[model samples]
Target: MLKGLAGLKAAAAKPNSFARHGVATVLVTAATMALGLLTGILVARSIGPEGRGALTSVLTTVQMLGWLFAMGCGKAVTYTLSRDHSAGGRLLSTWTLILLPLAGLAIGTGYLLLPLLLAAQPPETLELARLYLPMIAMALLSELMLGLILGDQDFRSFNALNFLQPAGVAVVYVALWAAGRFTVEAAVIVQAAMSTLVLAAATALLIRRHGLARPDPALGRKSLWYALRTHGDVVGGVITQRLDLLIIPAVLSAKQVGLYALATSLSWLIVSLSSALATVVMPAATRRGRSGRELVLNSLQATFAIGGLLGGGLFVFADIAISLVYGPSFADSALPLRLLLPGAVLYAAAAILLNGLYAENRPFTATLANLLGMAVTLGGLILFLNSGGILAAAIVSTVAYTLVFAAAATLYRHATGLPWRVFLPDPALLAALPRRLLTKPSPVAAAPANPAGK
Candidate 1:
């Protein structure tokens, strides 16, 4: 047992920067997920199916709007900063200033439409929506701050905030529930408060650590144009990725929506692992410049291996896992979970490629691919849902993600004219794995060699 334990640690300690970052990200994500699972259980027990479903709907709406307000600036920031530290810092400040009003506008619009939107819902759901919509504005503000931190590769801070935001909201919700102030409206209000507080703290820390210098007007204008173009692609990608949730609710019952939400939350375990790897790889790939092909290949190989392993494990244990995390009430989620497993794998592959595209500053292609996938998904859903229901939705999502991955792979190949197979791991590469092998150190390394490197 000790030998096995030691071997596991040794494997974990292997000289791979990506592995180290993946490990960190996994730890953080796992912590956050654990907290989320606990919170879900608590909310489920306290709020029952209807309340949880309403909360899910409200949260989803907030997320979609939040993405619009932030406009992919977080990723843009990460890609930019990874290349030019000074410009990145300046851009971060400028983005924050510009996005604040947009956040306010999004929230204002939600507030104004809340009454009409709720009037169209059941009385219970309407009340929840009314309470929930207003708080989303605060969450939007935090998202903008998140973009700043991500651009700077401040994962430690970013992860800290990520963990704190959800965990803190859970704690507040539990406290309120215990004190008999646990209305869904109150929960949303508390969530907004926690989100705003965390964003303020994170932004303050970023300014202090990175300085508050604003971008020059000319540089800011250039960066804005770059951001606008890149962000459009990101928005399209997000829509492609998240469109199912929007469509599922409209075409299916609330129960079906709840079931789908449960499956998606479970699938997030796999996607989160993939996202963690992409998060670490994106900055490194950006730093590699024109010579990023090797880095991109290695990153994809590692991501596929890790993501495949994690996703497969989830697939194997789908039933028991879903039962435990979400309760037997969500047993219907298991089939969808199993069906979505392969899609999760493809999603990870697409993510790695997307990062490479971002690093290459060819976000336009990535965006175009995403738009194509979105069209495919929407068309598939429209056709399939009429005949097949929720199952159709799952199939459409899987097919759409597969299309996105293939498109991204093709684009990467054409842009760099590199052999596409190099990005894919050969069976021989996996089969001939040596117990002992010498590997070249990554040129960029993980951390800067000196404090002044950045």
Candidate 2:
């Protein structure tokens, strides 16, 4: 046991490979996912299904607007910073001066347009949506700082920061639950406060480490171009992710939307495993440039093996899990949960390919892949969403997700010259594997003992 322990330490924790870094990121993601689930349970129980739907509708709307106007700066920042460390200060300066104001403007725009989006929603839902619009500003800036940490490959701090939002919300919800005050409005207010806390913490971290400097016009132009190039992918990706949430309101009753929201919230808990790998893969891909195909392949292999098992388990236990955790009223959410499990896993794996494409300076390929998936989802919803209700939404999503993975895999192959079989993982290894051992940590993923080091 002692020998095995040392072997494990030597293999993963020190050198900061995807094993080391991936474990850290994935572990934190798991913690956050668990916390998020806890928060979801509290919210669902406190408000019941329809109130949860109203809350979800407002939250989803804000997320849609924020990502819609995000301009793809996220991946662009990470890709750029991985290649050039010197741009950190200027990136901070540029975001503060330009991006912050733009975010405020976007929030204002969302407010003016909020009622239109939530028209089908109840009047209270529309009010909640407007109340949540300002949270979009907080989310945008918080994400910007987090992006910089990720771009710098400070996965340690990145993971740490990522943990805080969910953690804070979970704590507040726990308090509210104890006080018997965990209403939908309280949940919304708690989330906004947490967002402000995260943004403030991230900003302080940057200022102490590197004082803000003047924006570099050249760097801003270059980063903004890449951001805009990847912008379609960003917007498309968010649209794809949030479209189901958005559509459930218009086509289904508020109660139905509530059920769908529970399904999705549960789905993300399992899906975050692959997303952790994709998070590590993106910056690592930028660092590897064209040579990163093997990393992407390896991560995808791990994603498939891990995602498949977890998804299957959730599929089998959806009914019990829903009833046990969310109570019997949410039992109906199980079918949609089962339907979403596989498609969500596929979408999670596809993220690795898309990130690789973007990191390799092939944002257009990523953009096309995103648009394809988005189009498929949109078309599927338009033709069949009303006819089938949430079940149809689930089936269409699964199909769309599968198509996206296929398109991304094919495009990834054409772009990187990787064989198709690389998309498949070995069965024997799948049965006896830990993710860190799946691939050697790349040099780009290695960190100094210092968390804030250059």
Winning candidate number (TM-score): 2
lDDT of each: 0.68, 0.78
Clashing residue pairs, backbone N/CA/C < 3 A, model 2: 17-441, 19-436
Runs with alpha carbons beyond 4 Å of true place in candidate 2: 1-16, 427-454
Encode model 1's per-residue lDDT on 362-442: one tens digit a residue: 767667778878888879887888688767778888787788888888887666666545665745534432221113333
TM-scores for every predicted model? 0.83, 0.90
Q: Write the per-residue lDDT of candidate 2 for residues 217-302, one digit (tens) a residue.
A: 88888888888888888877776777888877876788888998899888876668766789878887566543355566667777
Could you tell me the C-alpha RMSD of candidate 1 in Å? 7.6
RMSD vs true structure, all candidates? 7.6, 6.5
lDDT, candidate 1, at 375: 89
Error of 2 at 97 (Å): 2.7
User: What C-alpha lDDT does candidate 1 achieve relative to the native structure?
Assistant: 0.68
